[model samples]
Target: MKRKYSPYTLPPWLRKVRGACAQFIIPICVFQGIRTILFPFTLDVLLLTLLILLAVALHLNVI
Candidate 1:
């Protein structure tokens, strides 16, 4: 059987880093989305997609 995941199991510094990333991720996603919309460059699109995936993973605590 697989063990359950717990944020408390993480080191203090890693938890802090995760907290900071969670706080900042949304705004960064929004900005990347806007930039992707305005520019539509291939690189920008790829970056935005990666950021969105990261945000979803973070939200789901799958990181």
Candidate 2:
């Protein structure tokens, strides 16, 4: 009694794009945070803030 479709089926292209973003978006954000934080003593305040923000995004699976 299965119908022809349900929410589980997404078109292939759309699904692929989401999969790709899920692969590297979080790491890139973290890398940028580290580069800013570690390279310059002047940006310590901004760096810590951005890093924490990225961490929260990572934990929440939103980034």
Scored by Cα lDDT, where does model 2 land? 0.63
Clashing residue pairs, candidate 1?
Answer: none
For residues 1-63, write the lDDT of model 2, one tens digit per residue.
865633237688966765665566677667766776677565665766776676666455554
Least well predicted 10-residue stretch by lDDT in candidate 2: 2-11
Task: Encode model 1's per-residue lDDT on 10-38: one tens digit a residue.
Answer: 99999999989988999999999999998
- Misplaced by over 4 Å in model 1 are none
Q: Residue 1 CA error for candidate 1 (Å)?
A: 5.0
Task: Give the per-residue Cα lDDT of candidate 2 at 34.
Answer: 75
lDDT of each: 0.93, 0.63
How many pairs collide in each candidate, listed in order?
0, 0
